[model samples]
Target: MRVISLQPSGDLTLSTDAVKPSPRPNHILVRVRAFAVNRQDLKIGPSVKDAGVECVGSVEDAGGVKGLRVGATVAVLSFGEGGLWKDYCLVPAKCVIPLQVSPATPGSPLDPATWAKLAAIPLTFLTAFGILDNLDLRKHDRLLIRGGTSSIGLTIASVAKALGAVVATTTRDPTKAPNLSENGADFVILEREGGIKDDVRMMFASKETFTSTDELSTPALSTTRINDSAGADKCVDLLGVNTVQDSLLALKGPGGICCLAGSLGGSGSTSFNPIKDIPSGVYLTTFAVDRVDMGKVPLQEIVDRVLERGEYRLNLDRIFGLEDLDKVKDYVEGNKARGKVVVVLPNEL
Candidate 1:
């Protein structure tokens, strides 16, 4: 088994060995197939004190556990320093999902890569669902998908579009328009162009049946010149940089809800006076699946939605092997990946 560990200096030390990980009575054993190198993985940037959590890995070998079997394919979510790059990984029985899926590409059996992609789908999809479904998203609801091209953005856009809500996803570059539009995004804007708030108003206006303002059942649009600026009822901020503050400025007053699934932007430290842009009646929250699934219902409803309608196509931006693990920290932190950057285990798929 092999795993990549990071040092404070930003160098990667790839260590290998066959060590058996202990699974609780409620645990499942998974064989590593394919894993992802996510933006969250770079937080520990070879220079940070203790890079909080590292996001990576997917499918696994089923070690004869209660619900998981030796040949059963499964995907595992690593929120913190989860070790899955090695040949085998262990997940709490509850955290493990029983995904009955065929290979994404026909006639192909579920390998680590396939399983890894499947596994990668859960966490992001879950985060998006919480924002849209759990929060009661509406078709007419406007949305701001910040960090538009991130692995996080891809999943959020797919689900939001399915719900019939017009989506305005923000990307760092304009080159992503064709790809983002194909994924169901109605409009794509660069993060700084007053993205969601500005573009959304124009799009809604263009689709308007009549030019008269009296015809709109909705309130006046709220914006710079519009007096009542139009804003997202729901905003998904994957970049955590000054999140609370930035999102507060983007959210519609009185009813908007902001869900912070990742702190990629930086922490919501309220760098400045929080009251300035903070609107009344807007609810701000940060949550994890463990907390959401507290007990009433198993995640069967959400998981089923993904299995039946889930599309796992990522723009395979780049592929790296064991020897290339060292370059990942630099590549990811530099924000160079065009889409989902994945690393395949050196062994055959």
Candidate 2:
């Protein structure tokens, strides 16, 4: 078997003489077809060598699992210590979500492009879905997504819109507002030089239906109050300390919940004065994709929704091969990719 490992010099190198990995009693072996690169991959330190979180592939051996069989097309969510950027990898049967690509589907004969797109969804979509699900978002709820241009951010916005929520999102880049609105955001608040809190507050104050620069529009803000307060029903904060305080203020007083999912700003120390920062009776929580219970996540329903809408597609910035592991890592680390970067493996291994 072949594997991609981080060398002592902090570069990803390929080794063709690596030994094959066997599946545990509760796991299944997958022949890697394609995998996606995420921001977490960049944070992998030198102490831990191999690094990959998710992939799309076929089951080679099911380890006697009843539902999973050999040669089943599946998406493997590798949340454990093991990496997915290899010729073959072992994944728990519970983490394998079979994609819908039967004869009746539109993309019956799944092409490489479609397979690549499906490969991009698991990690980002699952993370976003878990946070939103925890927040208990209801239809027509005024949902605010901080860091809306990020992969997980975009996924949450699109999925929330599909579920009938009027979504508002923030982005540092004003130009991306149109793109975000077109995808699902009803209102795109530009993160100005000073801060975005005032802009967000003003948007809620007007309670008027307005069109964005991109010409995307939504219904006027409903007069109904969230717990008798004047802000959003819930907020999914992906910017961590950089935006958490403002996010708290942007939510409804007592009943609002803020799910901290990402630290795109900085994961280091942050200052928060509980009395002034956190709203009265507002709940604050954090979410980790790796910590999510696979059995409880609605993976099947999420995939079904994407298949049904066909509008919210994962953007693919670039693709690479297993041997080009160094280039792939460099590309992702550059922080220039607008969407998911994928690595496709050879079929024969």
Top lDDT model: 2
What TM-score goes with each of the models?
Answer: 0.74, 0.85
- Residue-level lDDT of model 2, residues 218-308, one tens digit each, is 3453233334356787899888877788888887666778888888877777688767788788888888888887777776666666665
List the candidate 2 regions with Cα displacement exceeding 4 Å: 8-10, 22-24, 103-110, 206-228, 308-312, 323-327
Give the local distance difference test score of model 1.
0.61
lDDT by residue for model 1 over 1-349, one digit each (tens)? Answer: 5666666766666767656676545566665666677655554553433221222333344444556565665555545445555656666654555556666677776555554445455556666666566557788678777777876787778777777787888777788778788878887877663334555444434221223334554456422232333566777777764545566557665577877766666664555454555677776666565464523433445545655555434445676776787677678777777666666675532
| Model 1 spans > 4 angstroms off | 22-25, 45-65, 104-108, 111-113, 193-229, 241-243, 272-276, 289-316
Root-mean-square deviation per candidate? 6.6, 8.2
TM-score of 1: 0.74
* Model 1 lowest lDDT segment of ten: 48-57
